[model samples]
Target: MGKKKFHKIFISMLSFILIFSFLQPSQASANEGLKINADAAILVEAETGKVLYAKNPDKVLGVASMTKMMTEYLVLEAIKEKKIKWDQTYEVSEYVYKVSQDRNLSNVPLKIGEKYTVRELFEAMTIYSANGATIALAEKVAGSEVEFVKLMNKKAKELGLKGYKFVNSSGLNNKDLKGMHPSNSGPEDENVMSARSTAKLAYELIQTFPELLEITSTPKKIFREGTDDQIKMDNWNWMLPSLVFAYEGMDGLKTGTTDFAGFCFTGTAKKKGMRLISVVMNATDENGKGTYNSRFIETKKLLDFGFNQFELKEIFPKNYEVKGHKTVSVVKGKEKEVKVHSKEPFKMVVKSTDHEKYSPKFQPNTELLNDKKQIVAPIKKGETVGYLAVQAKERESLGYLTKEEANKARVEVVTTQSVEKANWFILALRGIGGFFGDVWSSIVSTVKSWF
Candidate 1:
């Protein structure tokens, strides 16, 4: 009997220790050499929309054809709402023809008055990033480029992209530099957004229409399919395994570059059921060469960092046990205290650097539980008196804790067990016990302070 009692006490102490251990601060040294050279960059998880890593994430810059992703987003949203049909044939406008005729710019020139379905135009815009096709879809959707841009800005605002702005449905800029191909031309229109804001836009894209990957992930395609009018092209995201910088699992999103934007890419990849989104904007050569490789290499580095430095951890396993028993006061319980647990398991993505101080955090809702000091009676079996929340935290080498949202991640928790109401005699006994307990605890605290 003595051994059994000791074992129970040991278990209780261990549970208590484990629960509070999470409150102990933990930290790791951040490597200064890990920084990437980009005007701005951000890495995020597609599902949770968590910012995994960032560098100058809020620095606003022009996003060349990456603007096409938003254009495609609006285009797809239109199709989903049935405002336009994918297979429905549409006319090529004079504006589209003029933009298509730019010999220096990539295009799938639509013969004036020659009609094509929405699907054809969308394919050209997404795969080839044909500026003319982009403008055509914009005009088809909103009646004109000017109007489509309004819809783009409105959509950007709705996505919580507060600092983003769109000047045109097609991302052509308004610079008149003679040496550059597709130099910004007329009315000073260019799609501009910060790297962080850009990631938010990309996150919403996959979250809303995940199947859009079917098209974006395509490495190469024939624009007109079997007709002699077909135009074959490769995807701009050269990260695909079939092309250069083949980081395994890289599917699709978009890439943009111009004399002004430099080079930018929003890439997403999936490995073992986990998907990550990475964005790099305005990556330029250290020597001022301004090659496209800088953005691709830096993006690969970012994804590698995300996949290597962090991993998903199930903080609370299925039927996980959290020992929470209060024997202090039950206003009217048959017995003195009650035990509680969670009905479901909780899980969250944990960074490898933050794993040492993991713990289960309890966020009991006293408002609904009706008891902060002591339990009020009339408790029913299977009632939720409180919640068990598990949070992910990591200390920074700066000798400081990161703000709650930035450093801590939380998981879902619910209740399992319930307490029953006690009789009047039991309630009286509990009241007396609680009063003495409080007195004893205060006296103990006072005595400890003297030591």
Candidate 2:
């Protein structure tokens, strides 16, 4: 080959290699330099529902026993609404008895014709992930497991969880129930949820019922402390303090594993007043086996990234005004324009390096504006005239969890002082003066045009 031709071919191949390298799938995206080993994962700030990081977050996957978080939410809601009491006793059903007796599944054996308090069953389900206990609570709350499954789906919809399904109260595969799965659900069905939805569910659950932490944080408890059937119940979530796979600041959460679901976890931790919620679905080891600790390991990567990389920073102070939008025009008021500022402080979880990337995006409220887009006089101080939201300068911002949250994310901008209407005499004088001014201006323009 000619030297020049060879040089050109080599340069083109080098360029192609560089482009291909750039297109390769990265372990993470923009500022999140951590690699997570899971089919789907997400980490979010608990207070704001702002997603800090995500990996295939919307991919639908079997959530295994992480489905129990929904069950826990319903049970807590029932107690709060006075529909059921923690002390209420429930009779063991034929379905619950059979499932509880299976040693292969997680359960605290329940004998038929015996009564157990709601608190007992809840403890078992929450702490040990006892499938039968979860079902018993479901039956007690909704009259039948079938109806309870309906309630679960209803509440999931109400909560705005998208593309989620609950086949049974327990996160077990339908076949695990030995033909006692809820009616209308396939025998092979398993509960499924996206990592984003799963994290949102956990966020809402904790925000609504903060007291559930007292139970889930327990490392171990006695299922029937003094009875002959007493069994030592150990929490499936090993990330709690003092647990085998404990992580600092980790607390109440749920874990799951099944043949189809692999291992999944919905974990939360609080440190220095910042709480983070994370979900890892189908986590596996190097061998692709969903070992017991694989979920925790993947979860730690997320929590660590959140805690170490992000901080709750005040993006804008309360009453701060955006540049180029610091004031709004007012008609027939004491002032031609009025100063406007944010009604509340804008705070969000963001990386330290990201402060420079954010800029204010101000939107005016058209309802309060005239055809000229000027505010009418008699405006009240602190009135909402506009909204201010932040935009990332470079990179796709991880938005809020829900539409409602996205709407609420902005800060209201209000007038700094009220503007009063001008008096009729002054308005008439200005109107008459303005007429002569217009005539003179027209005459001057005509004179200038002629010259």
Candidate 3:
């Protein structure tokens, strides 16, 4: 080939390769223009469990009072298990009352020996962010704050939260004032959690105790012992507008702030069967007013992107038949043929442009029974024998097994007989004699009737 032609061909091939590579999807380009705090952030679809966005989500950070989400989760579990009654009165212990007495502490101000019901304590802890109320409720439910912290850690591990540690029911920093430790081993600087774990914990709490919103979403509540005496408290979340907006589905969740943790919030909103959880941590005050507009605005942007950009589509309805499996052999069965069907629906979300690209694939067990076309004796209906998976182009959405339909298999039996040659003539003679005897008896009976 000429040198000029060779050079042109090589350049064209290289151009094609570069174009194809650029056309392929990359994570960085897919997430462009979404802004977040430098510390950590995550956005997730609660129903589909799809991670819509994440930024340093796994990085560990002090979560401050967001720890109360887990505390509230355990409390709901206790209620569901009937371990404590909603109206059960608990006497305020001296320890809890002393903690409440801290002027700096956000508390419900339970006096020593005074009693309050579990419901009142939960409202104060979850709505008012009352530290003393949380500790009291933890001790009342788990016998001690130490035991409750253990429960929180166990639940965290169970939920696969790897970057979390709990030293107390309330997420109070225990930094030493003198900046000196006896051995640097006592509590190991007990910081609470990360944005990913905090969002997950909030989601679980809402699912477990949806009734919490009935208290948290209220703009104000007045707790009073008598007609004239009352203490009124207002909600900390400012996103909930007094007048409903397009995002009226917004509901109750927790907010946190500390000098180290700097204005964090976990917010949940739902619309049209879809729910989303958004978290932001370590947001700097954008206006230099020590306000949390950074957290609020960034969270609003992420939530708006999620709610506006995507939707859930049922690619496959539950129990919808995909295709039949090849016949399998059954041992000790009559007729041979068994069909496989799906046990549940398959579904996924796709861009409105990509919905037509979805398809399903069936995978079945090829091992045949003795009969080679049917299942073995006593094969029950609705038993899963294979799986069906739905996909969007190359991405798989959901996979589940196909089951047998009702009364699809039956038993078949066979029998055979043979006569020896020597008995053949005797059998023929006896057959002719019996035929003549039957004719003679019929004639005699007819004659007797006539007489």
Candidate 4:
């Protein structure tokens, strides 16, 4: 074979290999321990908002003090908007004092005459699940618990948390009234929320108020202002300071337990460059006891499965070209060939184990024009004439258009240079001569038919 023919064959082979390499599919690694005994659970990546695992995640089950996440979200928004100052003193309201006095419920032990900073109350409520502190801060910020609940619902809607309801800042169950009061009022209402909604709310809280971690992660905090005796609240999260593999980047979210709601917890943990939010609700002890340790165990299992199974890999760099379109023909253009280029890069998430096997596909749309196939005189640059598309394993991903060149100027028919060259006039005169010749041929053919 001639040298030029061998070179052409080698180039064709290389092009085929490149095209095959860009048309492979990516796969995810298999995950273990996906089964957990909570009524509903979800594990999601905080940065990309990708769900790693979910089991009945959207089921609307009661989520106890996890409701405090909404309360915390509003508080942070208030602080960010300058509506509430962290160090400002707030007088303990009558309702807050009454709730604090109740030994059956969680309390920061606020006194009737004493004052506490908004930051301290927030710490108690978020770290210790202090019901009284939650209500006190709500009233201080919104002037009433009812208004705070309204704000919570409004924010929930704004966050696109569907199927969520908040009757109070605290997730306490409302009293059921079988009979009407003397004033003939209607039956009492109740507060409720779902595990999925709880997780979304907590995720938003951590994203908005990262400073809340300083309080939530603290295993112990002591309040020394209200009563003769100091009140110390230990963080209820058992996984924070107890477990051997307990993640370091873990922080305060909330835990909830009631006879009706069972054990519930929304946990947020971050490590390296990844953050995960897990929610477990309706977990019960082997003996049917409502406790949070069960929820914690399930959450840990989900997080472990996520960290062990998959890893994020960037397949392509930003603005990297994947492929280019074939040369296209344009009529009356100075440029003979126009090549199309991609405007953006192509990428895909693949399993670490499957990195060698996965491949990407690039497809560019090229169409043949009906005009001149050779260099002409009228094409302009950067004018869009056609488009190109990219695909992965036959699946179309993105598409963009090809532009014309700007440097190629149009050729005028009647210029002084063209007249001087004589070649332009010769070609124009030949075109006119050919037109007259065709007309004369047609007349002769008609006369021959009559003969």
Better of 2 and 4 by TM-score: 2
lDDT of 1 by residue, 164-236 (tens): 7787776777432122222222455567889877887888898899988999888889888788778887888
Candidate 2 lDDT over 129-201, as tens digits, reads 9999999999999999999999999999999998799989999999999898999699988899999899889
Kindly list the per-residue Cα lDDT of model 3 for residues 1-451, writing each as its tens digit: 9755565566557545433432232336335788665478877666544556777777899887778888888988999999998999888877677776664756667877677889988888877777778888888889877688788889998765768988777766544212221122254455567776787777667766788777767655765446342456565666665522224567767777777677787888777667788888876555543345666777787788777776666666655555544333333334234445556565444444666787765533323222122345445555454455443475422210000100111111111111123244655675688899999999999999999
TM-score of each: 0.75, 0.85, 0.72, 0.66
Q: Give the TM-score comparing model 1 with the true structure, all chains together.
A: 0.75
Against the true structure, whose lDDT is highest?
2
Q: For candidate 4, which ten residues in a row score worst on lDDT?
A: 400-409
lDDT of 4 by residue, 1-451 (tens): 9755565566557545543433211112122436777787776555434456666666787776788888888988999999999998889877777777766777777888888889888888887788878888888888877677778878888886767767777776544211211121223444566655676677667767788777778877776646574788878787785444366567756888766577888777776556777888887555655565777777788777766664544444433333432344433333335543333332222334644454433322212222222223344443333322222443321110000100010111111111112246655776698899999999999999999
Clash pairs, candidate 2, are none
Alpha-carbon runs more than 4 Å astray in model 4:
1-33, 176-189, 225-229, 242-245, 285-289, 325-351, 355-451
Q: What TM-score does structure 2 among the candidates reach? A: 0.85
**All candidates: CA RMSD (Å):** 9.2, 10.3, 17.5, 13.9
Query: Each candidate's lDDT (Cα)?
Result: 0.71, 0.86, 0.63, 0.61
For model 2 the local lDDT of residue 231 reads: 97
* Cα distance off (Å), candidate 1, residue 200: 1.1
Residue 75 of model 1 has an lDDT of 89
**Residue runs of model 2 more than 4 Å from their true location after superposition:** 1-28, 31-33, 332-337, 370-372, 393-396, 417-451
